[model samples]
Target chain A: MVSKDELKKLAGLARVELPDSEIDSFRKDIESVLDYVRQIQEVAVGDISEQPQGVYGLMKNRMRTDENPHPGGEFSEEILNQAPQKEGRHFRVKKIL
Target chain B: MSINLEKLTITSAHRHLSNGDFSVEELVGACFKNIEDKNPKLNAFLEVFGDWKEEVKKAQKLFNEGGATELTGIPLAIKDNILIKGKIASAGSKILENYRAVYDATAIAKLKKHQSIFIGRSNMDEFAMGSSTENSAYGPSKNPIDPERVPGGSSGGSAVAVSMGGALASLGSETGGSVRQPAAFCGLLGLKPTYGRISRYGLIALGSSLDQIGPFAKSVADLEIVFNAIKGEDSFDATTLSEPGGLVLPKKLVVGIPRDLLSNPGINQEVIENFEKSVEKLTDLGFEIRDISLPNAAHSLAVYYIIMPAEVSSNLARFDGVRYGFHKTGDDLIDEYVKTRSSGFGREPRRRIILGTYVLSTGYYDAFYNKANLMRNLIIADFEKVFESGVHLVATPTTPTEAFKLGEKANDPLAMYMSDLLTAPANVAGIPAISIPSGFSKNNLPLGLQFIAPAFREDVLFSASRKFLDE
Candidate 1:
């Protein structure tokens, strides 16, 4: 079983608050998935490769020229309007310090 | 409504529109009538678009101007995950409850060019997390066939929209089996194209490496038309591939069945029987059938679980109450982030994020995440080998059985996750797969058979699916 303390720490790292009531049930639910997925450890995969690619084969990620096609701030008005809290042209956030 | 929306496929609708047998507005109104009549109990749409009239007007003008395409004025339900500019895309999670899109997804952009009407955004599992729509924040979407049962998800509402005749088709996104599993349960045709085949620019990311937007319809041919409109190169999503030149298929194509994987006792006997009948039916279609080995496939589910969540943890980090979306305040900035996200996300997404953090944590990184990635490569290689031996596509039951009763697996996360077991491998391999309606279970519910084609080979899937269903 994943210890409650351990799950608490994981929730913190994941940026989620784990209410005390859910600790036990959540741990069990998470562990069940983990236990099921642990079967991959039994499979034999010999030598590990330095680089990995998924089924779709391609080279390095593509990059475009440093250019903005739709003049700057085209979508800025609509985007800024959605901010839950906002200041002049910026998203307002809670104090860092 | 005079028209039976369920009986009209895209081709027949196109013919009718061109022949002036019925106007696009009449067809669209019939669809809205179905939505009005059926959506009350089905809960297929989260919000039916108010702009459909404006869209319908443009489509009618296209027909009058003789500029209509096959998809012109066709009504489609958009899954909440795919963005349509200036519209709210909640993704069935509380975190994005009021968030609206600022730009259009590449797929939506492609469809818009054809003047396809957006019916509205449909419901889905939170962050596309769960296999059943029970995880949807709004509420579970009922199966059209049986209200007591689930419409397998996280594309449940999109599936229900087509199954209930609310929309002629729908656009759904998938990370692992979200499109195909639900299509199977709802008896609709669902296609998940190869990763990079459809651009993911405006999609709400679940797993960046595994996600793709797919189409759902009643007929394979309709699905193909919708697919062709949206697929191809896009500068917005760097992962997207350029359109390939013509693919010349062999006169004879071979299909491989991974019987060893299918024979698991966990699979429903009725589903197994139906799968066998589908196999036999394929033999009658003049295609060569062979039993093939995919030794590493058994590990694919585990690999998918690991890699998917690890990516999920990374991808979902953006919703920290800083910019747009649902937010809450706390003692400090970090606390604010935690509190906002904790309350913003539902149970399933929160659980996945935490599970993801554990696997990618410092001490466990090498053991879990790295091992899964290595195993994923082996799984992908296994498909490569089978295809190298001249297998055109791989076949399997889309799910273990038909849709189960609502709340049957809701409490047990493991059981809910297991519903996606057979379909997840294709996502792990980044391959294209389609679920075609195969017959029904004794419950009179729909069942499906899936065919997986190699990466970037959606052509094979479309052809095979059409041939199978047509026969």
Candidate 2:
């Protein structure tokens, strides 16, 4: 089971701040959810299969070579005008780099 | 002859349009009139498009030019999550209250190509996260049949729009039972085609592998028409399968029934009786009815809760408020990201996101996400084994019960989640499933029976559904 401190650490990692009053409620909820998940861990398996079967196994490489690559110049100014925030020639963003 | 355009099925509208009995303008005008009259009470629409007059003119011109497609000039509502250029695609979240789509979704592009008239954008649970539209940050969509009752959601608005005659048909996306359950509640036909059958490009991601865009209509035939038009390979969505052409029905179909799985205590007696009657009608029509056991069916909801939230955590990670949507310009980068998501997303979205993040976290990944995926494989294998037994179609109640009163199950998330128990397994297995109006409940509300077919066997599903509707 995940401890309350571990849960708090997870909340910090996810950038969410739980209120002091609701922390206990959230702890119970998270513990119950984790308990439900722990049911999955109890199942015993001998030789685990590597290649996934069914829908997940149906994943195929979806690359396309038939279409020619278009140049960046093809994008119209009218198209660029739709951005929520744009600099002079490019889509603008806050300083993260 | 002035008829309620909202009440008329697409097939009837097509007949009238072809006979020159009614012009496209008249039809579009009637729908707009219906929306103006009904939307205030129903709250089905988020925003009615401003350029509808020009769109109506274009559709009329296309009809006059003899270039009208099957859905030409037909007015439809779109679920807010599917992008339609220049319209607010909020997905019922305050975070994206002002977000406008720069491009049309692939499905919307197809509809536009056919000159279909778009009426408006419909409401949904915030970010398509909840079973009840009550979770919508805007407001809950009231049931058209009974205003005091809920229109089962997150596709509640789309279903109500079709049910209440606001639009001839509407587009809705299904992650779990979003389409079928609401369609059942509203007495409309809803189809959740096999995953990847319709392109998801431009659709705000919910659960990537599980999400599918579908149609809600008054009849099985109308659903087929819209499905045929929007279904095909798209360059933007590589997952879409090539159009396999029209599917033909077999001489005799074997219908599978997981009777034990459906014997839930919460299920209404009337729903069970109606399902049995429908099965009997199918049997009388020479279709073979076989009792089958899908014991693992009970575990579908548990499996879905684990897998879906994990995907939700990943898909919604993009909405950190840096690129688009609600962004709080804080003192620093960390503050901005933290403040934005904390205030932007609703309670349900936050709860699921946190739960999802926890499940996919390093120490918990193998125990939760990985096990869920393995169980998902087992569920698919179960369906494959049933199909191998020569079962052409599987039948179950679309929902356990009819529409409950508004706010009845809203507080208990687990109770609301249980409502999708019958519908989620098909999604987990990635198969074609549909819900058609079965009969009225004891309260006079509608009941729906869902029929599912193996992957790429939409033809069989359609044929069987048509038969059931005819019977």
Candidate 3:
């Protein structure tokens, strides 16, 4: 079973705030899920490796001469408008340090 | 009301629109009426675009001008995850509750070129996380077939929209059975095209590598039409193929059945019976049914859970409250991200995100994430070996069972994960799969018959599914 500290660390890394009430439940959920997925460890790792095709593998790198037919900024204004906190042309956020 | 849209498939709706038997306005009106009547109880639609009549008027003009495609005036429901520029696309999450799309998804753009009228965005599991739509921040979309039961989800609303006649057809994205399982539950035809067969340019990223936008229709033929319209290469999505690969129907339809996997204790008895009946039906149609073994097929769910969450963790990291989505004030950046995500994402997505982060963390990465991918390669090889031998298509029950009651598996993440067991292998292997209504379960809920064809072999899937439907 995973310890509470490990779950807390995971929540922090995942950037999700696990409420105290739910931390215990999540710990159990994660434990069961981890136990289920633990079977992957038993499978022999050979030369084969893959990335999910729908996400990445099927896409081949297509090289082309750099030409600006349609500039990237076409939807810049629209995209910026979606920002929760924006300053003029940029998205505003809390301080990093 | 006189048109009886519940029986009107997209093809017939197009025929009526072309023949002038009914105007596009009347068809649109009929659909709206159905939505008004059924949507209140079913909760299928998140928002029915208010200006749909304007688009219908444009379609009417096109019909009058004599330049209209088969989908010209057809009203279709789009899953909330897909973007329609300037429309509120919440993706059934509270975080994006007020978020508006800046651009149309590539699939939506393709459909627009064919003049398919946008009906509305349907409800989905928040960020397409749950097997059932129960996790929707909006509310669970009830199955139109049986209101007390869930419309199998994350695309539950899309399936229900078509099943309930709110739209002629609908589109849903699937990262592990989001489309197919719901299509099965709602008794509609749902297809998950080969991974890159349809571009994922504008889809709300869930598990990016596993996500594919597919269509739900009343029939396989209609599903094929929608697939053709939405599929093809898109420069915006580097994953898409330049063109869909051609499919050659085998001289004789040989359907492979994995008996070992089917006999697993997790599957319901009635579902197994229904699967057998479907196999017998194929046999009666003179399609050779052969027992095939996929040694790693049982492990697909495990592999899927690992990879899907890892991808989900990475893909969803974009919604950190800086650019768009729900934001909360915090003392610092760390607190802001945590607070925003904690509030924005629902329980299911958070659970998966945490699981994903755990697996991808140092020390655990090789034991879980890397091992899962290696097993994924093995699973893909398993399918390749079977298909390369003689099987034109592999068959399974789309889900282990029919639609459960609204809250049946809501709290148990593992149970919900099991709902996609049969459907995940196709996504993992990057193959095309479809779920067509097989029959009703003992409880009178819908059951789906799933067919998975080798990579990019949608033609074979269509041909085989069409034949099954006709028989």
Candidate 4:
């Protein structure tokens, strides 16, 4: 079972502050989910040679050299106007510096 | 009028459009009428597209000019997570309650090229996280067949829309049985194409590696049309293969049946009986059916929960209130991020995000995330071994049971997750799977038989599914 302290640490990592009441519930909920995942440990993987890579490897060699300057056409300024915060032409966000 | 144009397949609709029997505007109006009358009970659409009238007008003009594209004038619904420029793509999350999409998903762009009419956006589990649409912040979608039951989700609304004839077809994204399970419940054809077959350029990320954009239709032929229209390589999505090499099915198709997997206690007796009947029918129709062993198949749901939530935690990191979505006003940005997400995301999303974060944390990554990936490779290898044995397709019941009552599994997330056990294997293996309406339960609710083909072998699935439909 997942402990309350572990749940709190997970919440911290996720950057969400849970209420006092929710911590216990979340611990139980998460533990149940993990218990379900414990079943995967039983699957024997003795003969598998190649790791399950995603589609990236399958299509990596098929790359195209021709980069169309604008394949589907440029986004209109009106579209950019919809951004929550805009500075000149680009979307603005919180300071990371 | 004799054709019940609402029920017409994509092929038939194209013929009618070419013959000038009906216009795109008329068809769009019919879809709107259906949504108006049925959406209230089904809770299918969160928001209908405002520009549908103008879109319909453009499609009608294009059709009249005799230069109609493949899906031209076809009314289609889009799952809420896929961006459709200048519309809300909330993914049924309150966090994105006011967020508007700034661009169209690549699939939507392809549909636009064909002049397909956008009817509305369908509801889903928040951030595509849950099996039942009950997780939607908006509310649950009731199965059209039986209002008391769930329409099986996160693509529940899309399935219901097509099942009840609200939209001619819909585009639904599946990470783990989202599309197929719901389609099975609603008695429509839902195909989860091979990962990367369709670009995920503007689809809201769920599990990036597993998520695939696919179509929901009343018939198999319609599914093929939509699949063909939306598939092809896109510069935006580098993962898409250059349209897989071969398209034809082998003369003697070998279908694998994991008899032991289906014999689990969790499977409903009626569903098992129906599956047996389906295998019998297939055997009589000249296709070879063999019992195959996938000993590790039971581990699929567990593996999926780990990998999907891990991806969810990473993907959702972008939704810090300062950038986009519903922001809970606060003195500082950090506080704002915490407050907004805490209140914005529903319980399930928060639970998953937290769980995912824990699994990927410093000390636990190897034991949880890495091990899950290793097991995923083994599951894919299991399929490979079966395929080497000449099994072109694998078949099973999409869900162990037909649509259960709306609130039956709502409170129990584990019970709900178990519903996806049979379907998750295909997603984890990255193979193409289609759920077609098999037969009805004793109560007359639809049951779907799932057909899974090897990666990039959608053509084989289409052929087998089409044959099943014909029979």
Pick by TM-score: 1 or 2, better one: 1
- DockQ of model 2 vs. true complex: 0.40
TM-score leader? 1
DockQ of each: 0.73, 0.40, 0.64, 0.47
Docking quality of model 2: it rates as acceptable
For model 2, the superposed segments whose C-alpha errors exceed 4 Å read A1-3, A21-25, A28-52, A66-86, A90-97, B243-248
For residue B378, what is the lDDT in candidate 3?
82
Expressed as tens digits, the lDDT of each residue in B130-170 for candidate 2 is 77799999899999889999999999999988887878999
lDDT of 4 by residue, B41-119 (tens): 8899998877877878888888777668868888888999999988888999998888888888999998999889888
Cα-based lDDT at residue B263, candidate 4: 76
Candidate with maximal lDDT: 1
Tens-place lDDT digits, model 3, residues B1-471: 269877898788888888899998998888899999999999999998998777888889999998899899898999999999989999899999999988889999999988888889999999999888999999999988788999998899999998899899999999999999999998889999988889898899988778999999998779988999989988888888865445456779899999877977999999999999999999998899999999898899999999899998898898899989999989898889989999899888899899999889999998888888788888888888898889999999999988999888877889889998899999887888999989998788889999999887888888888889892
True contacts kept of each: 0.76, 0.22, 0.81, 0.54
Candidate 1 lDDT, B1-471, residue by residue in tens: 257788888888888888888888999888889989989898999999987778898998999897899999998999999999999999999999999999999999999999999998999999899887899999999999999999989999999999988889999988889999999999999999998888999999999989999999989889999999999888888888875677777667799999878877779999999999999999999989999989888777788889888999999999988889998989888999999998999988988999899899988898889889888888888888999999999999999978999999999998888887889889998889999999999999999999999887888888888789782
Better of 1 and 3 by lDDT: 1
Task: Say which docking band candidate 3 falls in.
Answer: medium
**What are the clash counts of all predictions, listed in order?**
0, 0, 3, 0
Off by more than 4 A, model 4: A47-50, A53-97, B2-6
